[model samples]
Structures are given as structure tokens and as C-alpha cells.
Target: MLVLGIDTSCDDTSVSVYDAKENRVLSNIVSSQYSFHREFGGVVPEIAARKHAENIDLVFEEALEVAGVGVKDLNLISVTNRPGLLPALLVGLTFGKGLAYSLSVPFKAVHHIEAHIFSPFIGSEPEYPFIALVVSGGHTLIVLVEGFGSYSLLGKTLDDAVGEAYDKVAKLLGLGYPGGPVIDRLYREYDGKYLELPKPKVKGFNYSFSGIKTAVRRLVEKGYPAEQVAASFQETAVSYLIGKLKKALKETGVRRVAVSGGVSANSLLRERLKELDVDLYLPPLEYTSDNGAMVAYVGYRRFLIEGEDTLEVGALARCPIS
Candidate 1:
């Protein structure tokens, strides 16, 4: 079946078409709002919603055109409806519902994080009962995945997420908006031996990055070079992630591991994962961030079982995976 997926969960307006039978994505289009929100240092919910409204139709047209399929050919429509900005989620949800209603097709609502967890399966499938580490701007969690729609959240961030920490640190160092990519690039330019950032000692599977972020502030105030600070920060942050993931692997005894979300695209993270001595699944860089393909794939899976959602289904600001 051909499924159309829309994601307006955050600062990206995305649309994609997936072919369930072929296990292939026909088209995936993402219009980033980074340039729009850069001046503000972070996403402005209202502006993100408006951008989605303006681009959703054009994105839809692009997706259909790229897929070489018309609206009537779509068997189902799916959209991210929860765990994101309320207004942004509504833009995609409303558009998806309208399309489904007009096309007389089944409509499904997908969780944004769930889509992240399923990202690794976009191009290749993995065996069941694998560990999923979802690290992104808004969320960080280690989940135990038993099967489709079956997830056990093992640990999550107690405060700010890793990506948020990156952005905050970048801002404190006078770096530009969307800190992850910038810091990741700059950190490689210089070895970070000048600064020693604190790694959070928080116990259990849960994570805490607020302390690390503060450490960056203090070190920067001490007149450390921004490049060295960025490098030190990235190393410490990624180390925390690796430590937590190792703990999860030890506890769960799951040999197969998959990582998703924007931060999963980090070179350091991928390099560390490769040395873990297990079957590792990492999504291509395109699927690492917020994109319509991940949502479309997850939606296609759900549509095969539960089918359509009622018209009453609405958007939500915060929805957790149980």
C-alpha cells in the first residue's frame, strides 16, 4: 500500500510517501525552519506553525509529484499528532485529516518518538527485541523494543536533552543557532585539551545534562577557547550517552542495538557505537533528523494492523511512549 506521511512536529515541515509492499520510500521532502528560527536561538512555536501552514500544501504537491502518484493512489494517510509543539502538530494533523477525508482514505496518527525509534528500519529491517537509543533536540531516551508498537522506555533525560544542551552550549560560546552541526564541525577543528567539562554522575538509566551545560558556561567564563570548549563539551556529552547505552545493553542483554533521532547523526556517537561489539543499526543521515520518511514508515506499519483514526483524533503537545 502507498502511505502518505506528514510531520510538522517541530521546526521542519516534512512530507513523504512510502510503499509498504516494496519497503521503499517513494518521496521524502523536508523544509527546515532553521533559517527562520535562527535569529531567535531556538524554535518559535508560532512561527513554526505558520511555516508549516504555508509549506504543507507545497510539500504535499512535491511529494506526490516526486512519487509519481496522485492523491487517489494513496491507500492511507498518516501524520505525527503528538509529543511536539501543539500548533505545529496541528498543522500536519489538520492537513493529513483533510487529505484523508478528501481522498476517502484511512488516516493514522503516529508518535514522533516512535517514528524516531523506527527510523533505522526505513531501509533495512532488524530482528525484534533490540535496544533503541533516541537522542534528539527535544528528547533523549533508551528504549527496549520488543516489536512494533511495543516499547519499554528504559531511561530518559531528567532535564535538558543532549541536543538541547549542545545548542545551549553553542549559544553560550557565541556560536550560531542549531548548535549540534556547528559544534560537531568546529570541535573537530581543534583538540579539546584546554577544558575539562564535568560528566554527569547521575545514577540509573536516566540522564542529566544540566550540570554539563553549566560546566561549559563556567569554563567559557574562565576564558577557554570556544573551539576547545565545544570539543570538550561534545566529548563529555557523547561519553555520557555511551555510558548509559552500555548500561542498558548490559541490563537488557540485547545484542542488537539501533539508534535514531538527530543527535544519532553525530560522528562521535556512530564511531563509539561501532566499537560496542554488537550488531548496530544506524539510520542514514537523512533519517537521523525530523523527516517525513520515518513517520511514513511507522504509519505504514500501524496502518497494516489498527487502520484509520477517527476524525476526533487531535494533536497533543506532550505524549510519551509507554
Candidate 2:
């Protein structure tokens, strides 16, 4: 089946078409609005949603053109439905719903975070029963995915997500918007010992980054070098993530693990997770961050597994397979 995926979860206006039969990304296009939102320090929901509305059609057309497919060729329609700016979510959903209805295709409402966890399996299908560490601007969650449509929420963050930490620290260092990558670059130049940052003591699979944020803020207040503080912040963030992944691996007993989200593109996290010696799965640089390809892949796969039947689907801000 050919599936079309739409993702307007945040600042990026993304669309992709997947060919499940061939098992590959026929087309994946992401139009980032970072430049528009940069002045705001981060994504402004209203601004982001409005931008999506303006560009959604163009991005949608581009995806189809790149895929070399027409709407009539698609058998399924998928859109991220959740845990995002409601208006942004609606932008994609409304368009997707209309497209599905017009084409007489099946509509699959996907959870934004779940689509992130499902990212690694795009193109080449990975084995099931793996651990998923989803770190993004708004969320951080470690989940146990038994299979498509089946998952358990093992743990999450109490305050800021890893991406949020990156953005905040980037702002402190005068780095522009979408700070994760920029700060990661700075981390290589400076040592993070301007002040010993503390990792939050989270219980079980749960996590907390608020304390570290406060620590960084205080360091900035004390007049530490911006680069050093940025470096230190990056170090602690990567260390904490790996530490948590190890904990989840040991506790969940899932030797296969996957990491997703905009922050997953961080080289440090990628390198650190490699040391675990597990069947580690990560999205290619292209797939990392918010995009529609993962959603299309997820929907297409589920449709294949279920033989074209229907199930309950909705735009859920908090839909956990668990």
C-alpha cells in the first residue's frame, strides 16, 4: 500500500509518502519554520500553526512529486494527532482528513511521540519488542514497544525535555533557535566544568531535568564562560540520557533499543548509545526531527499487518500503546 504521512507537530511542516510494498521512503519533505520562530527563542504555537497552514499544500505537493506518485495511488492516509500544539496538530489533521475523504482511503491518526518511537523501522522493518527513548523539545519518554499498536509507557520526564535543555542552554550562550545541534557543536570546543551540574534523581524509569536547568541558569548568573557552560550542559545531558537508557534496558529486559526525536540527531547520544552493545536502532539524519515519513511508515505497516480492516483512531494528545 502507498501511504501519505503529514506531520505538523512543531516548527517543521513535513510530508512524506511511503511505499510499503517496496519498503522505502518514496518521498520525505520537511519545511522547517525555525527562521520564523527564531526571534521567539523557541516555537510560538500560533506562529507555527499559521505557518503550517500557509505551507502545508506546497510541502504536500512536493512530497507527491518526489515520490512520483499521485493521490489516487495512495491507499492509506496518516497524520500526527497529538501531544503537540493543538492548532498545529489540526492543520495536518484537517488536511489529511480531507485528503482521505476525497480519495476514499483509510485514515490513520498517529500519535506524534509514538511516530518518533516508530521511526527506526522506516524503509527496513526492524524486529519487535524493543525499548524506545523519545527525547524532543517538549517530551522525554522511554517506552516498551511490543509491536505496532502495542506499547508500554515505562518512564518520562518530570520537567524539561532534553531538547528544551538544549534550547535553553543555547539561548544562554547566544546560540540561535533550535539549539540542540548548535550547542552540541559548541560542546566539542569547551569543557563543561564551569560548574558541576547535577543530574536529577529520578525514580524508576521516570526522569527530571528541571534541576539541571536551574543549575545552568545559576552558572550563567555567576558569570561563567558561555562556551564552557554550554559544553558542560551538553555533557550532563548526554550522560543522563545514556544512564537512563541503561536503566531502562536492565529493567525492561529489552536488548533491542531505539532512540528518536529531534534531539536524536545529536552525535554524542548516537555515539554513547553505541557503547551499550545492544541492537541499537536510530533514524537516519534525514528521519530525525519532526517529519511525516515515520507516520506513513507506521500506518502502512499496521495496515499490512491487519489486512485492511479498521480500528479505533483519533487525534490523541496522550495516546500510549500501553
Highest lDDT model number: 1
Count of backbone collisions within predicted model 2:
2
Record all residue pairs in model 2 with backbone atoms less than 3 Å apart, i.e. clashing. 83-317, 192-232
Q: Which segments of candidate 1 are over 4 A away from where they belong?
A: 192-194
- Per-residue lDDT tens digits for candidate 2, residues 14-54, read 99998888888889999999999898789898998899999
TM-score of each: 0.98, 0.94
lDDT of 1 by residue, 131-203 (tens): 9999999999999999988899899999999999988998998897899999999867885374667777776
Model 2: lDDT of residue 187? 75
Residue 44 shift from truth in candidate 2, angstroms:
0.9
Best of the candidates, TM-score: 1
